[model samples]
Target: MLSQPETSEALSGGSTGRALVIHPVSKTPPGRVSNQVASRSTGARLDEAVGLARAIRLDVIRAEVASVSRPRPSSFLGSGTVENFAELISEYEIGLAIIDAALSPVQQRNLERRWQAKVIDRTGLILEIFGERARTHEGRLQVELAALTYQRSRLVRSWTHLERQRGGFGFLGGPGESQLEIDRRLIGERIARLKRDLDATRRTRALHRKARRRVPYPVVALVGYTNAGKSTLFNQLTRSSVTAGDMLFATLDPTMRRLGLPSGRQVILSDTVGFISDLPTHLVAAFRATLEEVTEADIIVHVRDAHHPDSEAQRSDVLNVLADLGLDQPTEDGLIEAMNKIDLLDPTTRLGIAQQRLRNSQNVALSAVTGEGCDGLIEMIDRRLESASRVVRLDVPLTDGKTLAWIYQRGEVLGRRDDNEAAHISARLPEEDIARLRHRQRLH
Candidate 1:
């Protein structure tokens, strides 16, 4: 059971998805920052809340920022604040009010009573988006598991609806438990089953990743805040048509494609689900299986929308999530920062960006949309992946064209010597190829 103050609010209310987006500007704790995203003005936060609502096709009737301090235990806002929203809801005929703050369960119910509308906090809203966006089987299971965990403790509000709306003979349901107990029992059972399914899914995904490791291609994962041009950069690099959209969470599932570097070396580039500020803890735990791709990656490409107002704050959120996943620091050799979307920047900003990129060897200043500076990004990836591996000398029979061709195809040959009977070669290659050459030499 959640403490009355700390319980995550998920109200069950009357609605047809029409919403009023509200961003609460509350008092900051001592020594804590008031803003999550730097300079994210209350109006901007409210706008983002409206965007979240629109992401799911919700009809946003109104949006505003509500200023509050030292939250009232009963409603999280002052009486005046609640009364103001009540008037807004009545005038706008709003069916839903999305509070852009974590609300206790009690606060949610009180808000609903005062406004005569359904109320949901940020966590609940994100869950709804994930539910609507999840397409793959694993994604659905992950969303369901998170939703169940979120719904578990909020069982207090929706029980009345469950009791009132059913057409069933109360007969052999004999001595049926109260609606609350029934919901608890059903949800408990479902949650248990979802957990089991997700566990199996996690193991299967692990096996798949292990199989990829054996295939000799290093995994380069693209990570950033949602709508950070990851998919755009991925498509530009790999020339594969992946869905890139202008909305948050447009890419919910992790996508992987074969990427060919300028040196003719192939790699597996992965586009992962983006991170966000105030991400629900339930989601973090639930999506761990999918996010293991980030942990297991050989390289992490931090894609940033250089034009975004909250770019730095978004970067902080991504780093925090990475740190939480046990990656305290990105690999120095394999890390790259693609300051993408430069096409959207002004000339002065572009000059500054160029100077910044010059300071950081790993930084790639590229506009993924216009195909600018992409070759440099590829070269950066190649250099980083190569720095760890060393070149080796090898000898193959002159008549063994197949073996020689394979070596040329898989390695960067620095030099080759031709003799009547054999060919000597010096090539930059991984140990896997070196071993393969030695095995073939023995067989010959």
Candidate 2:
């Protein structure tokens, strides 16, 4: 919830101090929107919540899992549970309470009023983290847009104390607008401006993508769950010093670098923001400009933390995000799974993973930390990109040196023969390069 008082402090701009992380495990039946996540233990979820707290440099004084058989409308937690945590908050001098679930705006207000402390839910916590981690102008813009959108929904939490209507404007009607209406109108205007700026940014990105298409470099995008060693693998493959830490969302902005594959093909490798379970829709929409890079990619590499117990579940989450991005056919589009963190696995499990990779042409087990099997991943990438290319025969006039040079520069020559009037060449080229060649021929 967003408010001018301590509630605002919790959701938007909380200070770093003693914090209590709580995960409410729901016993609700399947197919309902509950706090329970599949393929992960309650302890693991609580631990992840704690990690999220620490990512923002918060000193986590206590971490606990509260079981909720039934949710209370006011506080989301039962009275007994809320009272118990209130005591715990006081005992630990907790300044903030982090709830690892989505809370209604009313529920958030009620909780804060009861505990007498700042309370933040999962969405707010994630927004806060993104707000702090954003560095680029576009990133800052997107974060602010998302934050404002989120705040707009919870305006009821603010100005509740100012129920009395202020005097009307001079020469205006008798009734005056409420503070909530004023804040809503202001937020709506800001959101409109943000949309305009983001639209321009989106256009600029489309132009950049168009320019890259002209260069005809195949783009390979890396995607996976948060803290799944994507940045580590990016650094290992590109040798660029991106911040690769053992924390969620270490890389927020999209990063790209030129990578030379084993087949001597130069491809643009993009490292994108990692996906998480139950990611906020506001965030997904805000980062659409950044995610368009993935949709336009020539190939996608799904990096996975193979050692994590929830690795499979993490894969599902990433795939779901990709599907939401209109990439429902990721596997059919030739997805490559790079099973990272093999170094952490025991010898027997690692050997099994290696064997499995041999059976599955799309899987590659590797350790980015130790540079193990990374070459194999690169080789796999080369093969996947190679498979995406087509062999085409072109007849170039002897005097058309420009066309001949363009083909040779952008494609691999398979077979060539020179005649008196023209050169008949067979070459493998990417679809984009092929289209360009055809367009040039049509113009001639």
Candidate 3:
């Protein structure tokens, strides 16, 4: 079990801190309910929000639902709701207000002033989790980039004191001190440096990818909503003890391991950071390098918690993130859906849905924890890989022994026969390598 910080002070670098959760729900119109209405179970959302807050060690004194407000403004609650929140803040002596929704900097600042507390929106909370969970240098860089991007908009809040003027001598009393200005300038420089460093990291990652390609193994990436059992599935598939938990954003660094499919084909499977709704744009931008794994994947396994009430919504959110990563094109045919955690569902329902999906030529459903249906999933992956491969039958001249040797070394030779004039070879090769071989055959 992941340990929670004993107090907010231990987590946030201070003792005088408390958080109030504000989730503004808009009332539906008289006749029709807009699809955009907040329809998620308030209890579930609150549970998740509280879990996230606790993970960050925030001292959440009180968590409540502010009044449902209209025209949402994508930020602070309505003026009236803000007023109520102000009163609650005073009553609770809250030091921070954590809005469950994404908040614009303008609205964030306004809310902070009204509540007389620091305001951390959903995006900031996620970034804080990433900052804590990132372990690798590349992962750290990605998190830092995302955090900086998120902070850029809120710089005004962080440096508000910069606007104040210090008491100075008539001409130049030792130059008025401006802590906020200094901090802002320092942060700006750090952002620039991080960008440069990330650029280098991206290049390093590119080189690593090139090396992997030379080994010629297919790459399978696991992607899904936060707490959708990605790490569990990854651990199940790879037998590697990566951190797995029920909390949101439990795994931050992308983990890769070699997996042998049922057909005896080996491929690299990577577990990436989980996606979430209303993810901050800066966080996405900063984590672009980490997500690039998805973009470059030979196959994408979209894992989801099959028993979750919001499974469909969670699927939508995962796809939205994939779209943002430029993997939304119709040409992305290698995508597979893994309805994970089937053990949590009724046996009949799980089997029925799995059978239905299989019959429809869709992907697989399995419980990553119990290992149920795992073999079928592996077989499905193998079939997909086989379908995408190119089959080649080469008749090489007996004198061209080097070519025959090369073919044997580079391809998965299915059959071979020696003839007086040539050696007939049947093999399965990657589409690109097959094309190159055909071009070379014609040239020779």
Candidate 4:
């Protein structure tokens, strides 16, 4: 659990006070400031920080990028910069200061005291968003586990009661336990229990995957940076009613649906939590069970917001996260790129994207909002799946309409001939479907 004064209200949607979002650009040579992402500008990073703050309903009164030539160990910012923000906080009466970087426990505490406001770093802000956006039981568990893991390291005795000692139960007791120790112990116990529950969740997910394999439909997963229109594209592809919005971390829970391809074959389309630059490691580990839906997907779609200025940087960030998840091959060669939000692009840029798509069969330029070029994406998927299927011949009784319909729905028909007694059919199908058809024949 988070300490009440530090994060209880801020993370639980109780705090609606004014906030100041700051992005610190580090100066490597003591003279030049550089953005965190090599291709992204400083303003973009600050904008993202502000967006993150607003995602949790924080009333952002001010936002800026602070250049740091050298960091002070106590505050992670130069003394003058700290004093400058302190004045801004006082002037605007800001109740919260969002630092767009990871802060050590001491630095976080010192900054809060200096600014006379609650301070949460990037990790904390992201966690707060996750805490608010998580709706499912599993999502809550994963968020809680990640939150606890992150909070464990920042136990800097923020409360006065943490220093007090509890009396031992024994009469001739030696030293009693301090409140901080008790809190740490309790948090540790909760973490252990959560890990056990998550392990069970992982096992359950594995079993579900196995069951899906039994009646196998190729799984296609949508993955990209937060608010890159993955959920929107998912809705467009599968015709689902999942909540899709233009907010960061808008969709936390994984949603799956059955989708019919152009070839009349079907697939399982999965919309998963979006990836982001500098996504907390604890979150990546804790949400392993949920992300397994991505790792196990037969087809991976890398969606990009082509209209955004930092599009290329966001692409690199998403690929970095995928690499961390041990999915190197997908981003390298196997994945399909969906250049989303082309409806927002100017005609010249959209034309360029169209030309790029003509050069690469795996690249698709589409707008999930207007449903433009989405058919092209579906056709691309259909062609890929068709190329991977094997042709097989089947003979069915004229009376058995069910099996014939099943074959037609599950495979691409190449040829068919009807006789008085039976129908001979040739179709392209997956090996799993072929085996199942053979098994169905044996049962009769």
Candidate 5:
């Protein structure tokens, strides 16, 4: 858990606030930033950090990558380096310093004092984004749980905002219980309560999922790095009006819609929250229920920004997050890759992507903005779903029009033979649908 540092909005500037973004690269062993994907360059990672701050309307005044041979215990940067950056901070009147690295309580507070500005680590910034964008009650609860978990660890940071803010009787302490201890107790109680609520929500979500399973539509979930055009592609395929934007963390809550395939088969297309490098541990734990949609999906579609320079790195990051959720996430028929935003790619890169697709049947280069190659993506999904089905034979009485209609509605009829009193029908259907149909018939 990372503490969410306070940010100041400059009242004088026409913009929201002046923000300084920095990506710290360390060579030493301890406190090294390991969450970053191996393929993403340090420069690209800094650019992403800047974009994250901008997502919340922070006016980035300066950005840079700082090289650190070793981390200092007090400020996480050498005294000279800290002073140098502090000079720049004072010169530019920057209100926020977005550090693209994890910071300890001591390091965060010391840096804030030295720089005379509010400071936040990568985890804190991500949490702030999740907190702001979460719409549903469950989503908001999850964010709060994560935020509180983070705040609990920063009691030693000497933040004025956390001082005497929580109200409670000091029975535990005889006379003068420090504000820090009271705040910690309040946060702990809140965390436990939130866990209870989240557990109940999880059970409810499970029930909802079970009901969806009975509907017999296979679930296809879309996942990718932030700003990968998932919502755009989702709207393009499902004809839904889900909010789509060219911003980071644009879609915080999971959304699902019944999508019809070209084969007359229907599937539930789920657009989930985007993944990012070094996703906070608390967030991963808090949003477990929301991400269960991916785990339960019959087929996962990985949407990639074809134009992003770090697209391959982003793919690796998404896969890593899925792995954390215990998903194998193989690039087999169960996983289809949607190479989205091809319209933003150059002619040469677009052609290269097209050539690359020939080597991988599980991937389709597409432009959600232009409706190009979407049909191929749909056809690919149709084929994968079709391959998962098997043929089953059923006997229905000639008078049972309802059962026959149900079979037709749920499965592809392969063959039918009518005898004197009953109809012998052979049809291809998903295993779950077959079980459901058999269960329905047994109940009748």
Candidate 6:
């Protein structure tokens, strides 16, 4: 058992708050190297659990490592450990107990009875955080759907008294008799309605995406670990004041702005919600519609906080998520790494790493807070876009002025000449749109 000091303050409405964290550790035999590795990994996970609890301002009163018992069925600490935890709860007056693992509804209910407090599993805590952080309608809806799905699984706990309720209606009866059943049915209907609403929203978003594609501006999406300075870099690049806080999940909505690159080419820059280690699978599934922005982007900018101790691990985590989304394939040649927060490092170290990364032709390094190396980043983007584009030289007859005007509007024309019979035009367009333009020219 490990105890950390608790601050004396009101948790909510002057109610004292204290929480206990329970982590189950496997007691595998010492000879196996695999078990050793597993134990080491479990220790690291416990540390992260503590850090997360502290980040959320939870008053952690005690942390315990209980040896696993009945692993096949219970997958949690043994009965003796539960008894000891119950004793600790009585002694410390804990209002909540956070189990750093997924729990079945029966396990959750049993634990709550033993501790006489609200029991929250790792998934529940993350859902609560997301619910609090969601700022946009789509974000809130996604979170709500995920929460409802998770809640549906725990409906067993919710209707524990079903066996005791003698019914006159065979589980679906009289007007007011089956109140619990009615409530459950109503909830099921609501969940169905929400799913329909979300489907409609997805369609609307698809139409909006089509409209953006018609504008023909390349989109650059910023992606990285939470608190990796994505929103900060977005603000620095676009000069728009979006919420850039040090807290996790600060930017829930995808924000887009037109950014003028170094070559004077305008592109759309999108700042999306950040990724995290062990992000809930349900949350990922729920947010896939919004995260498709990354897949649609012409360039994916991976921003990283160079100052954090676990920056490398954070990078790996972000890459794992990207790989899961199929955005880490070698075919995705549009990935750019942006190592941010160089200003927080010592000047010599910052310059050395920046120079090294630049030399390796990996990506750009910049400090979003101080506007350092931002010009180089923009220049790199412009260069990549220019390289991927194709230049077309077309001589359209002056009789078709509309074609020339459309060309000027759709692409960057480097030169235009008027001849007695035709208008000679040299312009650059994205490779994908070149064929369309060629067909339109043939029609003219």
Q: Pick the candidate with the highest lDDT.
A: 2
| lDDT against true structure, model 3 | 0.72
- Each model's C-alpha lDDT? 0.76, 0.80, 0.72, 0.79, 0.80, 0.71
Give me the displacement of residue 430 in model 5, in angstroms.
3.2
1-444 in candidate 4: lDDT tens per residue? 223343323322223257889999877784676545678988888888988888866789989888887677889999989999988877777767889999888898788667766778888888878876778889989988887787777665332222224311110111222223226787799899999999999999999887776465778889999999999999988888898998888899999999999777788999999988889999999999999889888788889999888999999988888888888767423478999999999999999998998898779999999999899888877777776678888889989988887777666677989999888988777667788987867222
lDDT of 5 by residue, 145-207 (tens): 887788787764322222222211111011122333326777789899999999999999899
TM-score of the candidate numbered 5?
Answer: 0.83
Collision pairs in model 5 = none
Q: What is the C-alpha RMSD of each candidate to the true structure, in Å?
A: 7.6, 7.6, 8.0, 8.1, 6.8, 8.2
Worst 10 residues of 4 by lDDT: 167-176
lDDT tens digits by residue: candidate 6, 1-444: 001022112111111246787777666666744443322355655666665555456688888776773453442567778888888877888767778777776777666656656677777666666665677888878887776667666653232212323311111111122224224565588678877877888898888777776566888999998889999999999999999987676788899999998777789999999988778788787887888888888888889888776777778888888777777662334878888999889978787786878576657889999999888888878888887787788888899878776776566677889879988878787776678876766422
Question: Per-residue lDDT tens digits of candidate 1, residues 333-369?
Answer: 7688899999999999999989998888878899999
lDDT of 2 by residue, 1-444 (tens): 334333333432323357899999877777777644568878778888898888877799899999898778889999999999999987777768889999888898788778777788888788777876777889988987887787777775332312323211110101222234337888799889999999999999999887776566788999999999999999999999988899988989889999998777789999998899889998899999999999999889999999988888888889899998999877644688999999999999898998998798889999899999999889888888887798898999999988887777677677889999999999888788788888867222
Summarize candidate 3's per-residue lDDT along 1-444 as a digit string, tens digits: 001212222223222346777665556678976565254566667777887877656678888776554645544576777787787777777767778887787776566555655677777777667766778888877776676566655555332212324310111101222323224667688789999998887888888887776566788889898888999988888899999897788888888999998777899999999988778777788888778978988888888888887777778888888898887752435877888888889978787776879576656888889998777777877888898886778888899878876666566778879879988888777777788788877222
Report the number of clashing residue pairs per model. Answer: 0, 0, 1, 0, 0, 0
Candidate 6 C-alpha error for residue 301, in Å:
0.9
User: Which stretches in model 3 have alpha-carbon errors above 4 Å?
Assistant: 1-17, 31-43, 59-61, 67-75, 157-185, 330-333, 395-426, 431-436, 439-444
After superposition, the stretches of candidate 2 with alpha carbons farther than 4 Å from their true spots are 1-16, 28-37, 156-182, 396-427, 431-444
lDDT of 1 at 277: 80
What candidate 6 gets wrong by more than 4 Å, as runs, is: 1-17, 22-47, 54-57, 62-72, 156-184, 328-332, 346-352, 355-359, 396-425, 435-444
lDDT of 4: 0.79
Q: Which window of ten consecutive residues has the lowest lDDT sum in model 6?
A: 1-10
